[model samples]
Target: MSNEDFLENEDNLFVQKRVPHDDLHELVKYGDHPIYQGLKDDQSKAWIKKSLFEKLDYQTKLNCVKEEAMVIALERYLIPMISENQETSYNLALIRICTTLTKGWFRQFAIDNYPQLINLDKDLLSIARNVIEKFPIKRKKPVLLTHDPETRVIFDSIRPYTEILSFFDKLEYDPDDFDITGIKITSPVNGNISVTAIITTLCKYNFSCNPSASWSASVIILPSKEMEIFLRNYKSSKYELISDLTTKYIFSLRIKANTSGTSWGVGEDIWKPIYVEAKSADDVASILEIPGLTGDLLFKYVLDFLNPTLARNGETPLKHWVNELKSEGAIPIKPEQHLWYHAWNYELKSLFM
Candidate 1:
């Protein structure tokens, strides 16, 4: 085939093909991150330029170009060249790059910076569209912020379903009336049935909150599907499991600023099957209470819950309390864990804050 014919035929061929390059996939899949940033650096950029212009077979050329470097070339150089010369016949090297690195910033930077390429180059455009169609941009979820610290405080209690619903209803009625700085719930994953139901009810209750409330609240709505999966399939060490569960994979609920009405864990890491035995909504009302349950303390709780034998072997509640207090700089010197039981059992005046 003539070079021109090869270019045209190659475009058609690659547009329909799904070439898998592992490094390229990672770079494009996580385009927003710094993983591809090095490609734009001076040394990498030189390498990318050399690889792109080199005269080589298609597969050999692709192998020569680092995935991240290819992405950088397309975003910073190649696409811009194509944008300026839309009708020019790009070589097989350029065509393969476009089709191979089809997602994330590679697709986005092209679409945004050189929109004309869509109309000007059908083969490249089709490949880009395919990637976008396959991996569409996700919409950010609406965050629901509860001003009352009580939402988090009550999370520990075994409240009934109706009572929990009532609490939410009250918040929906006048979220602004409350002290406006407590819990922040950020929904990370989409299509969570539980999250969807909760958000739907929250949106339903036309509650109002202060127009000017700014408090850095705690509480992240971590991705729990994996946690559920882990709980159902817990075949690992307690520490390893807890580490996976508690490490940075957590997300929270966050309320957006200046919105009239905005709407909005425990299994993969510390798979506590006891949580599964809860028979009804009422029984599981407290399942979502996962604020401030981080660090060594959280791991301790999960270990004890999953293995009660360990708890029994450990010191009693009083002993734990005394030991904690004896340790200097232990705020709430009395330690709140003991207070929770005593206050509830003895019906004594206590503070949750």
Candidate 2:
């Protein structure tokens, strides 16, 4: 197909929008950042050229987070406190800075600053909270943020593809049967630890191949010999498995990779699961772009790839598409984006596209 044909094809309509970082940052007082003066910088430059519905840069969604010196940044957000119900409350000016209320050492700042924390821009809160969890702080009290009650949200926890590769390295299994039972989740450290679950992963090709391709996970029983390191890393370690799983895979919850870098982990407190769900929701459904990946669009995207057409240049369309992504430096941003890289083939896995 010609350039015009490619652009006109419903499958290839990449919606480019005006970059609003300049205004957005200004709105949130991000423009006055001492280190950077202008609204347009290397960061916004990247986003500027990026279309709203552009193909994934393949960076972990965390890469999209606005990173800052944790302590310094935390100091700025203010939370209000109620000292009294009457004139005393108005006179006291009961507002707390995040730093003073948070502990001196590594500890959670959000909880103490919760009333203020809830006010964070929804997307920023997800990336920011997950990043905070990565610090070596005591996370004994993680409070979950609330979601809008209007719509239902789905979630999936993804380990980086490296984790999948490390676990599946030891054994082989039938693609047709793909048994979760026989898949031994033995760790080098915990030779025969019991596992909670062996979940077959779902990788979406359309968004990102790096983490999406890193498929499958076997949760190691905690406090066991295993450190849950993936103990090894890589999806190429599982690419062969992926090539097959791609064809048979089905629906998977939208993935949320904890920035903590833990592959095999023990559960946190009772509220842990809910806190995770909140973060996971932040990662996936946080952003929706029209002319973007809806069920219909994704379906069409898969159909286009499945029914590839020959081109005058002697290339299959899908291969060309993958090549184009590569050409644009859409290489996997390693060091693990989410927890896993997942993959799927079109026959049964088309929905993943």
Candidate 3:
């Protein structure tokens, strides 16, 4: 049987009801156990019973329990089972747990957040990667997601009616193709784990807001052929689009003038992108002087316009710009846009770096 079929049936072996108080205690029992102490030993598996597995599996489905708790429960189970042996039963159980837990939001969440936990064991990493590979790839209808209050505030602040075209991975759409109204943000992957985490977190957040139908749908737009090879062969590269062919971490957002998709506020050539390096404060000056831009009036307008999409990538453009400028020179202008630019210009600027 297929992995899905196996998981679907195995799920029945676990209880499908609310986790009882006793079960929660059982979960905590395993949680307190030092599962991480040993490697490749059957003794580790001795503590985790079938009942505990059922409890962990059942609680994973509940919204009340935080994802970290489920992950802890998973690690607790994994440490023991994987430590014991690579027997068929152990391997199959790992696959089932990986596949079931890494579905929907949890799939992207794991990829975006937990690299260390995944790579902690070679066998464990294989299971996680396999789960990612087998995820259903198809065009899902655009549906609104329920975000927590803080995230909701961030979502609400974003100005509506904008068209963003993201070309990081290719599924049904080609990278050169521009007859679309989506947003593309590429991860500035430089092989450093922390930097990559920042890049992926931003990309995932953007994807969360406007996820494509499949992994292939996010086209990786390559700036050069060399970087493409580096990324594809990088071993831990998560973006399925980077194969020996394409790559780039470009972000573009355009304001839609009306309900009809035809009219654009920036320019008719929406396909042509103006790449801006987030690291350079000088780049913002050049953008301000772009021909057809009304300068002063459009300064805040442009920043506000890009705010929604950029916010997804874990850095606010204006906030970053304002903070960067304070270090360079005296603040200019008193308007709220300029004020926002000036006030935080002197604040701590270490986070994004």
Candidate 4:
């Protein structure tokens, strides 16, 4: 096709062919449509440019060329006819267009620029909220924010409450608190003996523990007093370690590795250490189900540990052992037997086994 024909064809693709003014489409197709040719003509370019500046000044109160260009492009080309007013259909079309164009940024910008639009018609806010909740944005994690009634007001007002809550949710604590001072046991330590040491340490330090929580690779520290009492109450000889509670609080500690090194060499090497709670031997066994640990072993561990307690009217500590076993490792399973996966799986198996 000729260059003019090609440009016309491309422009036609952008402008809908079937509209109320079908004659306009035919007129444009024949290169005789006044509006179509006017829009396409070099002479009309000046008017188009002027129109954009006018709209930008009217809409945003600014007249910068780059800013005006985007507004002009959207007004003349993208916005549907139905979105020209504040009526129900207009609001809906506006939301649809904003969603199509801006995705996640729509809500924040809409709230900033069009607070009256949301306040005058709550349905628009609701629609926008629903759309934003489902749309994923490029950020640290999948967006989990939901649209509640209260959030509707927050969005309309650009309030600080929601922003403050969002800030706290993303906060990460300093790594030093749990890592450096917490218990550290090297491999080859007797399981039962290690358990005893852990419990004794906790009890002596007064660290409170909950035996029911799953034993996982988490870094949280227990209070010192609760840690001490736990150690005094735990006793088991056969297992690798008889943690008073299966779940332990761990903290990431930074250790200095090299004295003569520069930069991070003399800096801290970080490691997470866990504080464990004691559970029934059966619970412990079920928790320890290290991939190869059979169902029988799982059952035996629960039964043996809880049997004496059960005989003495104590409660069975194990809950949903197999499911816990199945969910033991990191999700979105690793692609290779790398160090991180190996370490993660090893830690998981060790905790449960």
- Identify the leading candidate in terms of lDDT: 3
Model 2 compared with the native: what TM-score? 0.19
In terms of TM-score, how similar is model 1 to the real structure?
Answer: 0.18
Query: For model 3, how does the per-residue alpha-carbon lDDT over 1-353 read when each residue is reduced to its tens digit?
Result: 11122122121111221222133323323344322222213431212233333344433322212322333333333322333332333334333333442244433433444332232222433442343355322342432333345533433332232225344334343332222222222212321211110011122111121111111111122222334456466664343433322233222222111111111110111111112321213232233232332222222332343332222111223333454464465444232343222332322133254
Question: What is the descending lDDT order?
Answer: 3, 1, 4, 2
* Candidate 1 per-residue lDDT over residues 124-217, each given as its tens digit: 3333345446644345343222223543443333112211122223332333222111111222222232210121100111212211122111
Give all candidate RMSDs, comma-separated.
22.3, 22.3, 20.6, 23.2
Model 4 misplacement above 4 A: 1-122, 129-226, 230-353
Candidate 2, residue 134: Cα displacement in angstroms equals 37
- How big is the positional error of residue 183 in model 1, measured in Å on the Cα after superposition? 12
Report clashes for each candidate as comma-separated counts. 16, 20, 18, 51
Location of the lowest summed lDDT over 10 successive residues in candidate 2: 262-271
The residue-by-residue lDDT of candidate 4 on 263-304, one tens digit each, is: 111112111232223222333323322333333232222222
Query: For model 2, how does the per-residue alpha-carbon lDDT over 1-353 read when each residue is reduced to its tens digit?
Result: 33232322222111111211222233234324422222123541221222321232322111122212221123122111112122232112112212322132212332343343322232333332443455323323432223222211211111110022235445554442232321222222333332222334322221111111112222111211222333333245354644443332222322222211100010110101110011011112112221222332222222222222211111223333434544675533222111111112222233234
The candidate, 1 or 2, that scores higher on TM-score is 2
Model 3 alpha-carbon miss at residue 151, Å: 29
